[model samples]
Target chain A: MIARNNVVEFRTDLPGYPWQIAAGDGETWIILRHKARLPVTQIAQLKNITMKDFNWRIFTKALSKTLFQGTVSLTVQYSEAQHHGEELPRETWVDEHLARESFIKDETVTGKNIVRKDSRVKTAFSSILLDKNMLNTGNESPSEGEGIWHLELPWQAWLYGTGKHQNPQVEKVHIAQVGLNTLLLEILIQLTANNELDLLNTQLLEYGLLPREELIFKIEGQEIEQILGVTVQRVFHQPVYDLESKKLQLRNFKEVDIIFISAEKGGERILTASRLMEEMQVIPFWPRDWKRPVDFGLFNKWLGLVKVAADQILFQGDYLWFVRSIEEMGTEKITALEEKRKNTLVAALPPPRKKPGEKWLKKDKKEQPQSSISKKAITVRF
Target chain B: MVWQFSSAGYMRGQEARRPEVLPQANPEALPEVTVEGLPPQVLSSYELKIKSAERKSPNSWLLNTSQGEYLLRELPDQSNQAKTIELYLQFSEQGIANLFPLEKTKSGKAYEKTEGKLYYLTHYRKGNFFKGDDISHLRLAAKNLAILHRQTGGWRKEQGKKQNLWLTVKQNRLRDLLAYLHYLKQNKVLTDFERLFIENFDFFYDQGQESLEHMVLAGQEEAFIINNLLPENITLLDDKLVFLDITKWNTGPQAMDFSLLLNSYLPLHRWDLDLIKDLITQYHQENPLDQKARHLLLAQLRFPRRYWLYSHQYFSGQLSSDELTPKLKRYILECYWRDICLDQLENWLIGEWDKNDSKE
Candidate 1:
């Protein structure tokens, strides 16, 4: 089982000792040791792993003791091997026959008749073989593609009677390894590579699990059209951003990662990165290495864990600046927004005298229907 | 109007002693009441007088008298004032001096009549207005209010009408909000804020409707409730707290009193549930709440009155949107607290009820 520190260790009654998985400096390592000696190391670079590099197999056998006694045995093997070579040397084989036992619980049903053969084979091979021709000729130059033996052989093995006699009586054995984190890490790396990290973060923030920073955007120029396009599709229509007026500054943000770009039509506006996460509908797998109270150090660690491409860090300063701006701008535009709101309201209201055949406008009101425009001296109540 | 002049023959000075022979009433000089229209008896009665008059729904005088300070005021509804004063008099008889406007006129009438105008004098309760955010004061006030409510519980003769008073108030509030929404829509130009309000009108309107329905479902019995329980009306009398105004007393659900006081005291958009829960629990300890009462209380709180009030005022031009914008945002933020308060109250109520159920 994996510990809180992400270290994993498991033991099996196999030839080797326990297997351990650990992370150091964001790199994961898998270690296998044999009875306190002979340690084999495998580096699992989660960012580089694919589905084909991992495999495991299971084997089972049964032994008969007496007329009604039997024992089942199970073994599991896991290996990560890369293709290096194909053929090997084969020598001699010895076969021995053994007696079989018939045990039947039912009177009419007997155990199947079985023939068993145990084969012992021995073979020897050398990775480095001396060439006698080169020794005799005393050749000073080395020739390529020259080896002691270049042999290719096709070999096959089968159990007699559909492998019934080959380890046939064993039950089930469960074998599992920590491979999920590797796959998840791979997906995250891929997403970062595709520049979709912001999108994923956006989805997470939208789920509303994490705290969000307040951001302000001044959507104007052609951005008005862009905003209207987004607003029109919503089920509930609000007239908040549907204007094609001046450089209208609107303040209110769902998240902190925001960007504003100028375009020819109305200017394009986008909320990027940290703030982008706010609009996310689904929570993404956290990219951070450490748990909560996430600060700058934790964020940097997360970036390292995700192995964010070096090019992305160039914009890190920009992201930090944007976040800082959001923090500084808190509650500043509230007053201005409110002012603009009042102006918009006044602009939206009709002059008391302008409405055709309006009865609510009193005789005195009709004389100066719109009090706001009447050059009336302002009164300071406070 | 019994205008007490300088007692019948006291001013007849033909055989009176000279100024030097006459004994001085005060060795230390008293401030002169020099206004031409002054009542002669008022000047003679109070030695040290500092008086001012201000109109606040009634012609009232703030003056220092020989007896003590007093708020002399006229009443719009003499009969209602009499009824409330009678209820308070009974409460005072039970040692609930914190309630009941203190010290009536010598005639025992809560109000004295002058030119057919009914007036009354109350000894100025020495204390500051309930202005601070100290929730302890709120807790104390709530406790006293619950006591006051329970003590005067049986004063209402019209039980059926009072029982439905909360429902009527909610219905009226919802009606008012609707009217304001209509007024907002009637404007020719609308701001983004106004538009947003209109868009979310149904959601807010539904909250009002739901609160009313919950009140009806709870069906709590009514008690004598202070209908206008503004925080400013509460005064700290030395160690004791008292509500100075009994202008709008009515037979209503006790929950109305709780809602009024809370709505008045809680800071804008900061509905600290701990404060609310503590206050409620403190009050409940004084006067236990039944399941129905708890439900009614929650229902009363669930209505977003501040948001509605600010928005209504802004749209009606009674207040400039710009002037109330910060306040509006505050109210909006406070809106979230309503749900939190409701959820917590519901949990506590359920927990308490379950414990009671197990005991039974």
Candidate 2:
């Protein structure tokens, strides 16, 4: 299994952030642990500082994708510099194990009642990834990049999510170990389909798996033809899978260990060690939108479990992710979030509601809670 | 001849440890194969007359009687691509050239897939492979080829698609070669000889291309074969040279056949232009070769180690290293890229002489 997901930023808290939600069984995730004062934009080296800025994607671009081979999800993160001193908040998964089998039916905490959400990511950026391959000890290496990195398919034993793959079968079975920041080599991949358009760019950029970096093979009963170099240099922009075809017909692969091999002139022998199961937990129900309020049916479920400090907002949901554009917020987001020495933060959140039917408009909550004002909806400006 | 070499055949004992890959229809034993469709009289003695002609390929049996010979090729349980190639050879131009038409079953099927595998029976051609001294048969063989090419020169439409019989120097391969040349130049693997080869290649490839304009043509975008000349397929019978598989674009650049023969013959007899000239004159008299064709042929005199390696692996099964033809070890070294020092066309030809000298 190859891990692919970009994390834009990791900060404490901000107003009106976007998040996303994706659903699948055992997907390779790029889960990021929010660390402030890290030397990404500041010193460009490892150092410790603290900032209580909220890190998340911009509004309007939280996308939820289904798996390719089987039913699953994949999230790709990016960065947008336009957002200034205020960006979105860092993503944290609420332990799904806490979800009681009877929780969803409880009307007060239904899914439709959550406050905010994100649908897809607009900006590409550096991120820490988490996948299902690691143990939950928060021990995993983080990947940094702004480019989309799609995995070579069909995966072996593990299932893969969506990045416009041809096969819409739901999940891809990947047999190999794939952790965050792990690179795999000698993975012979063909288009999951045989379409003229599908094959147009399957062998270039990230899509091209041929002439892999490190491989060992020879014809039977012939002199060992050590194929040391690639006949062609192929890479791909993005791999497209059709939601129509339920098959992952990627070609066979020769396993090559590239741990010690040179990066130049070798068959595909490198493995991108990923961190999914270790540092990240797949939230059972997270918001997948920023512009639109969480559907009335689903929002209630999110508002119930989110914990908060002074300005910190920690809400966990399943298969949901978020992202945003900096244009909405100014550059102060990067400055305020650059270097602060706080592990976490506190923030204001709507007071817990016992249930939707209970009349909360009894002149309360906000400083100017409406006195029985029923205008269908009132915009809550943060 | 059933290749009597160690590396060639699959013996019965090899499968002892593994479970017998029994036919799908009947897992207990070898399924009874009763092919239908032959003349009733031919079927009368089918089981009784059949004899085990190939002992190593145990499943393949031959049924022989006074009427004619029928070879039943059985598909083994394990069907790898190698078996597929063997089957192709069994059904392809090999058995066809020998004047053996497969027996069609009553249902007009070329083969019957018994238990998820295909097999067919055909009459075997009864003729010994022409040895080195069969000179008188060269003309007859050449005439047969000219006739075959003349008769079947045009492509055929099989299953509504055009079928070509010739193979070209695949353009992709040519591109690969050019790229390889660049790589050699870039990696400093190019030697003086290899540099000379580059010049000669540019010269001859152009010549070959020019001569081929009239003689050999490229395949169509839809489908075609060009430059399909190989050694074993070209035979001499009764002083006539015959090209066995002469279909579609495969029939052009007639010098290619002569080139391949020379490729084999040069190493067999080095330092003696007598035999070379004789064969040249013979081939020229039979089928006149143009100057461009001749120059291109000479330029191609240097065989790529890629093809050499294929041949070394092919013949090592039958002939001992000493009994093997000359220039073999050089071919091996060349295949491994160690003989790049002898990249010059002259060095390659000299390898034969060097081997002959060592033999002396």
Candidate 3:
């Protein structure tokens, strides 16, 4: 009789969704509803793993009894494509160091005009992998592009510790508010179905690359209005105290913005706008002499820059924001901002009181005021 | 000031709500605790009959007489009886429902040291222990915690010294695990199973360290925390929730206490977002949390505690698959849902507290 523990069921309710397992059924084919991809260079590369092949007993025995709330009795069975195939496409092993050098060369197309577009993903992946503490650093090779193992993007970002990113303090705050991993998994599951792997993967990849930074260069809403030649009403407004200045200021924050400019030919024009961090805006660049609606070819060029430079970009409405780190910055200012916010919150709270019969509360000395000035929401123009 | 409840129609002999509530035995089934050296006045001229006895945890008994029921509790050590009495009295004063030690002994003491054993007697209240799945019960537990913390604020301030009481123990355990894994490898005693555990240690340790750093950054300690806020320790009465074990209370961040409750309950519900939101909202409504406190709670939840704990046990050669496997399964399941829950909880908190945004 089968142990019943070996039986496994997979929930592929969401495409590109990681597996949610439960123990049931004696027959051992765990179906993948979304066509879970395996980089199958050849059929011979496939490795069929059965319950007897590994310690299915340990995992099933562990997961079944308590968490899934019942006994999981089954023999585990699964197959995956591996690197070395028995027959066709036999590849020679090359030195990884040499391959890395070649990749760098390929990354720069010709004559100092780096192939920035093609190498952007590699760069982002490399930056994330270089951090020794990130969980991804151990499993993923920075230089390797195609692999048997691929982590869906924002999930990948989470495994790479949030603090290891370009803006640690902001990411730290962000991670605390909505844990990166859970937020992404839940949102992705809700937004996509089993057949939408391609869309889900693309969205995940894009959203995972977006980052949050304090000194950001956004085309101020009014400036965007001037460029698009339209009067726009802000829907979401907040009174934010800017970290740099001590004045309170009202600002509009949008998760995503797409501006449509009428082309001379008179159709529809689409220009995606994303915030670029101040430090990365080394060269003043913007689309110029672009006809409305903007040419698709030209827009793609602008989108490339947005993809690489922006820490966070909202690609579509109600979809996840792309979060990534382009350049590492000193976190001193961010840390100071965090401390100030906490102190402000503490100050706003009602003072601690002594319970009746607890005389010590009355005897306590008053807390000392913070020496640092509170940051203003509005920055003074120089 | 405690209100009495009638035990009628209460299903008196059924298993109490918690798993920790041992099966109740008949009153005559067990031998009575020796009251040999205790002053006669402590019993107050009533014949005390044992209603229930628990030998495993804190060694206590439920006693009933013609007047009313009383709980006779035994202390682990005679020296700490005074401290226990003091804490219970403070808890009672703060509107926390606790069995305050009765001041009936001849010496006007809350506890009596008889024949080198320490014991305290208090009026027992009838209540059902809390179940992890009871949403209302969970909400009440969190609200009661906030109230308890608010009341204990003054006491927390008096004990001004800061202590990372478990830091040394955890750090030492991590170091020992590393050494043990190395020794196993060097001696050719490592199995494939052991190798898998060894491979995962770095990631788990690093994850644990990252969370610990976040806690240090948040500096969240403020209220007197009940170190063990397990669901079993909370009981639901007709009108109020009563705390069972008061012996493990300590001074620390309320996050530490709340996180323990959340962790315990998360697995029970398989990390249901609606339930988690309800629990956190109830707690926040009672005790408002600022940015720092929220982050501290997240940090506590985010810590790779199960990994560190089991790895420590494995290194100590104390890990049995029966216990560790189920916990690991629950950990994985909760981790899968952690981020989603944290995000919603944060948004709810920010939406509530962001007065300027709401006004705009």
Candidate 4:
């Protein structure tokens, strides 16, 4: 902590992203949007984990991401600031710790960066979603419109943030609308009956962990712009306000890791993932195994991120963003933050090695025991 | 007929159009019968019933829809809480009833879960003077519980298979008391009343945790269910009594279930514990009261509010309404907190209670 004629101590934790805090000393800093990283050693672990166990990689990466990015506030000793002589006309005082802007962000914004480019499943499903009120399609009326309130982006949507989980082909687009049927309503009503379900359900009200809403889905196996047989609804574009409907209030916000994997159709695709690259996009992934530079279905590989636009899940925090307005300076700062973010990512990517009996270009000589593979076609009762 | 529509936009109750209800009949009864009157369900067998009426669980549905009424239970799956079904006879005037052995699909499964928890459907036995109240009948039940302990002694032991936290907790306390016993060659923690209990434990544990289990298997409340009887689970048709839904755990010590009942259900000048000694004395074979068990029971009796208040706190609102009447709830809470401090006096000497009462 360095004391000056005016400016207080600057932050030393983020040395890579330095701050020149001598304001009007002509020293200015583009305050980094966020601090995130995945070291080189972690990458090796992730690689080993990916080869050794798939779920281990997933759970590990999820946990690691949270551990690295989890925000915890701290406060050291601070004494009352010696007030400046100049009648700090608001602005100057605003910067004062006494009047310091707590830096509250909008908690949400127009979503972007959702798409995958893997060559796995045949084609991908992609849709666009925008904040509902962005269009200002205002309609204040009686009758059927009573429940129709302002459609603001949710303060915290269920599947908001996380590294990535989707197809590998859809072009980068600002998601416009996503149709979802959080099974929360069914769970709640089913629980209110005071039967055995209600009794068992009582054990699940912990924070950031609620009984997940059974995902209402329809998959035709073939790529269609909309899920086949499933009519798509508009994005759940709404404010964080509860609509007073027990159904709406009880909505479960959760984060799900949906991994889409495929090799050269017939190649062995198992690997370790004990550790992982903290931050990376859909591109520039280097997989082992030679010949033909194989991949999964690239066209529909990426459908984008699942942004529900509300705290509709207990698993969230990855998809949130905030900028006072679409100001270029703020957005530019964010971009710079994104750039610095990439360094920590590539450095930490796990370099997986083929096991002793395994070969890069060769598929395994033996298949897994029949008992290990799942046979039950996880059926959902409509 | 569906009763209501929940916010999830689905019909509630019998006609909710779930996949299909599983049958609750013996598969051998109807090899190929399609129960025409029932909703579309996957049933193994079909049979005649006198009637059917919707009832709260343990007995989910009382069937008078035919000649002889049966009980149908809609079970929940992966459910943790245990409720009695399959065996408790409810002979209420609600309908016609008859007693029959448990009937299950030929697969020999007593219950099955389709969309929810498992349910059991059985013939309701005809009976009289069945007090179904939650906590009474334990007094009369003391003897019946003893009989059950004697009868199902072997099979039930095989059923429970594992010891819960009981033996370990008892032994942990005993090692300290046992060492004290060795040091003083006397029961240090027990009064003469409790000394008997400690001796019981010393003698019991001398044989080990298995001995405790044996005591349980052999109808020992000092090692199992207390002898305090409740009239609720008992059926006294002019002294021809019956006890069912009987478990190895609930049929122990004469003090096990009875003392608590007197306190909880009967409005008395402080749950007349006088009934406890009497109940224990009445047991057909007087198992000597281990001084240690006496001490433990009295100590436990001293903390009765804890067991009742806490038990009620977690599960029961039936004693009160949705449990929201805060003043009453507050009174219970205040008594609980007050007792936490005042209980020391009550635990050591009842006179302290009168002293505190006089000061107040």
Candidate 5:
């Protein structure tokens, strides 16, 4: 048995059988020929241990459960014999140079290091042939000289040390008016809840390297597992001021420190920051009290009554009710005023008692007979 | 104070006569008209006897003739009319079946000039307006637009003119926005719409500026584009999508059409990024876009075109405060979702470029 990292090589001494290797979380067994030599009995025992001890289903189920923690598990079934003659020559120049530059200690460096540090390991793995038919174990029709292998492991395990899984710390310091920042935060929270932060984290890692003026996420037709890929360094929430306030305090006013990850790399940060400030400035300073209308029961009742009255006037032509409402409110005061005027008039002029057939008009004319003549004389003088 | 007083007066008037409570007259009623005033020579040229005529708009007439229904339109500008007729003929020659072909007169001319006005006839097309609810319809429209773009790619070259107003348009929008801001500042008392505009002014102004910057960054690749892809301009005729109007076609980046289509359809879908991605993918599948074209598309989408349009209309007196207020409110709501979509699209585009770089 030859063990290196997660891969273990076993020499099958059976005449026609080739050497077998267990790799990738011990879920896959590959048949191949390697330089390592081992006893025939030990190789056979190792093969039995690989095939009999490992439970693929239980291992996969456990890995799937960990997917919510930003780990992706994939089961890849491939074969090596189909690509036996087509394998490209492995290039070891770069790896050898790097290994030579580093200090090699006998105590730390072993056969495992030699295999792991060599580029031939990757080249060998890359030669593992895969086709549509080979992907399905039940329908795999192996051609002549083909060796079938099942490789099941979390695809993201290789990226463990690459810093691709690190999620950006999105801190919302001050958000005004529940606008874009709030919406973005909500989306992030949702993505995290759905266990889709893996894709987001990976995209954000890429985004941090190449930041644009605007970090736009295409949400149209995005699958459930796809990420929004927005890299917000820090969100600085500031107060929304009206245009007048902003203009008045232009000199003294301090802008929000909105640090978009891309802003660090580009010279357009000032423009972006100022734009954010302007966005804040234009947001009308809604008074805290005015966040929601005061829900007054009396006011609501009055509004309802007014609405009903309006409906009646417009649709039913019911003006009588409206007039009656006004009259009812002023009825007592009007009656009292009328009574007082009646008393004053009665007291000023003596009440005249006329016979049933007497003409009140003729009496009035007789009393003011000279009045008409005076009026006519005054008119003539003018 | 003046705005408040006006509002109070409007409220009183509204109370006195509620429009919703009152019975409304049918606005679709077509006025009956006789063909007595129509030019006899023009009718003879078309070789048709008009049975009845009804004015569809100020310059268009729906005529029932011996040969099926036709739209008799009065072309206002002779030069533009000629160019339009030429384009129509070109389109027909290219086998674009979406556009309606003009009926030829007896002399084999597209138009007939009688008195001072030039008139043209086209067979009336019947179809339902594009409501943008179905994905299949959107995909079809996108694919058709791609085909149209491919055919019109060399239109500017053939015409021997470079009508690239991409930057000019952004400059004008920015200018209008500044003017609008000045107008708002000059007002002693601001209405609700004016106040809202002032509140949201900076954000949109920033967007306008960014769009200009993007236009500059997006290299010049001129192609004839349909500038107006409004829902009203598109009609679904059977399984195919037909463009009802093509007069607004101009030479610009192919992305302009994509932007216009998004502007028309995004709001209807509540600015779904998935829908936009699907649309772009469909279009890209038909006519592949380069890096510059994609950048231009992004730049066009980033601009607050609708916001600028509404404010411009209000400031220009095309729309009153009452008409603009509700539109502004609805627009503000749309911006909330639209901003999210824009952010998502930008990130996606950057990712795409990164992938391409890695591949290279």
Candidate 6:
């Protein structure tokens, strides 16, 4: 069921390979090599399983009774042909993959290298015709053996999908690639959920899955303006996530990509890229970690309160109300702390000594006659 | 009033009445004992033994006494020194201590009245004169003024009467300007000052009228303002501002103080818009200013106050033709830069107002 721009073809030229089968939408292709003859019924069942229903559990269960022996390899590719002429160089993709691999390797908890050797950029030549619209301008005709670089993953067909799907069909392939990071995240989440404190604590140290490198894809400035609903002068990315200390928990994809937006008028706002993605409701595989610190929840509550106060300022045109609210909150906090201190240690402390001039000043003021005039009746005229 | 004099005070009174103890012809020389016409009973009433007395201004004296150094000044005709003292005492009671309260006499009177004149004493404060050139000083002064405003703002609920004081002030000035124009036109032979006043009359008249219209539109809020907030009246001592003069405190629009401060200081900076903005922001941090207050402030700033002042002075013969001509010329030249700054400020204010309106 591949589109015309994403036709996958198989070659049976190699000597050791008997059956060469390829099936997928162009970005993610499943290549199968069978030692035993495959039945027509099993092939029909495999075809019926679209990418949405395709998951590790379903794949394994569907093939449980099949008396077949074969190897299934998954290849994920990013190419200009698949995207709408978006140029993601093969070198850039390879660099990102290596960076992610290095990040996983640097983690002390995951001491063993989890990245498989087969998960590398593998060059393949395909003369499959593409839709005219898929071709880049000035390249009216492409020759055979055009280099198509792709990652040949060691993952079997059973480990391919995790059941999450994006809205647009085209983003499904990229979402599948992102699912690899999600899988690693899921392990951490499950460890935490299962109350395996010792293991979870060990893994929580430097346990990020995605590379903290800048992404090849960028959200345009106009899109950012739409998300913030403010006139943006400039947007800056400030990366503050620390994988070694695990300071900022990996609750969202691209959490470190914090946007510092300065508006045209005079104010500034900071927002996380993950928060923006959450607002956009895109990026399906971004799973939020449920077991967050209580401080984070309180901080979010304060942020919401500030936003409500700001709305009050805007609606009522009483800016002082917002300032007073903040001051009151501060005063309440200080008073609460002072009360705690007074209850604990104040009784043991000696009373503060009066300054040398204090007594005299007090006596002098006391000696003055109380005026008969009411303050309300007194007005100083110029 | 019955004067109570102690046995020692009778002798001091006899000594103060001597001609040698009176004000000398050379003001540079300190008086031997007491100020001119200051009754010895007034000094003895405060239990003050004067060491030396020096004239500081027309009706003020710097006195060093056995008690302490003090500034003794006479109040003007419209001044209610008792009410001023009460207001400041109330302010001090309310924990607003920026102003120096009036020191009471031994009889607990706020001021001593003798020969139909009112005189009061206060502890002499020492500080450097406030510098308008220093931005930090400007910000501090603005913040302190705002604090004073906030304290007095509460009084609005209790005592302040709502009045369009700016409208009255602007109308008076405009009337004076029109009278000056008529006087200049009536002159059979125009002097240089009269000629200059006639030439610049139309532009300044339009500006005055425009500001009056703006004031009318802004209406009024009950605001107790320090009417004379000149830099000379503020002192910066040990990072704390001491408002030296509280006698001119009056009930008016809150913008009156802000406008007065800017008018007094903007000439030092040649009317820099950013500096004005910064000062406003500093003030706003302490006490929030509404859009109407800002409009009134801008309106007051836009009016050609100096133009009117010089013309009125010249027309009333308070200033000679030779004296008024140069001052008016310089003022007209300065108005170019002033107008540009005011226009930019107006644009910014309009833009902000529109932005807030759109938000609503």
TM-score of B-chain for each predicted structure, in order: 0.74, 0.44, 0.74, 0.45, 0.79, 0.79
DockQ for each candidate? 0.00, 0.00, 0.00, 0.00, 0.00, 0.00
- Tens digits of per-residue lDDT, candidate 2, B243-264, equal 3332213223344444544443
lDDT of 4 by residue, A1-382 (tens): 0011221111112111211110101011111111112111111010000011011012233321211111111111111112232211221111111111111111111112111122232111122221212222223233321111111110100111233432111111111000010000000000000101111112321112221222312111212121101011112222122223312111122212221111111111111001111111121222232222211111111123231222111111111111111223578788988777655422232335446875445555696533433334332222
Each candidate structure's TM-score, on Cα atoms with residue i matched to residue i, is 0.41, 0.28, 0.42, 0.27, 0.42, 0.41
Residues A164-255, candidate 5: write the lDDT tens digits: 22331211111011111110000011011121222211122111111111211211111112111211111232332344443111111212
**Candidate 3 lDDT:** 0.38
Candidate 3 chain B superposition, TM-score: 0.74
Better of 1 and 4 by lDDT: 1
lDDT of 1 at A259: 18
Error of 2 at A58 (Å): 75
Regions of model 1 farther than 4 Å from truth: A1-382, B1-58, B77-95, B104-108, B157-162, B168-189, B315-317
Query: Model 1, range A264-306, lDDT digits (tens) per residue?
Result: 2100111112212212111233333332211111011111111
Off by over 4 Å in 2: A1-382, B1-48, B55-62, B74-98, B132-141, B158-175, B181-262, B270-360
Output the better candidate (5/6) by lDDT.
6
> In candidate 6, what are the lDDT values of residues A266-342, reduced to their tens digit?
11111212212210111122234433322210000011011122111110110000000111246888798877665
Question: How well is each residue in B219-266 modelled by candidate 1, as lDDT tens digits?
Answer: 566677766555556777555567766766666678767766666555
Q: What is the DockQ of candidate 2?
A: 0.00
i-RMSD values for every candidate model = 45.7, 32.7, 24.4, 32.9, 34.4, 42.0
Error of 3 at A180 (Å): 23
Q: What's the TM-score of candidate 3 when only chain A is evaluated?
A: 0.15
Against the true structure, what is model 6's DockQ? Answer: 0.00
Q: Which lDDT tens digits does candidate 6 get at residues B247-305? A: 76767777777777776666656678899888888887777777777778877777777
Residue range B1-360, candidate 3, lDDT tens digits: 243321211121122111222122233332244344344344443234443333324466666543355666667554556686666654443334332224233344556665556666665666787776667777887877765565555565436545454344334444544565565444322222243344345555665565565556555655677665555566677645667667765566777778777765665565677887777778877676666777677666656555545444444445543334334433443454665665565566545556633685
Residue A376, candidate 4: Cα error in Å is: 96
What TM-score against the true chain A does chain A of each candidate get? 0.13, 0.14, 0.15, 0.14, 0.19, 0.15
- RMSD per candidate (Å) reads 37.5, 29.9, 31.5, 32.0, 40.1, 37.9
Ranking by lDDT: 6, 5, 1, 3, 2, 4
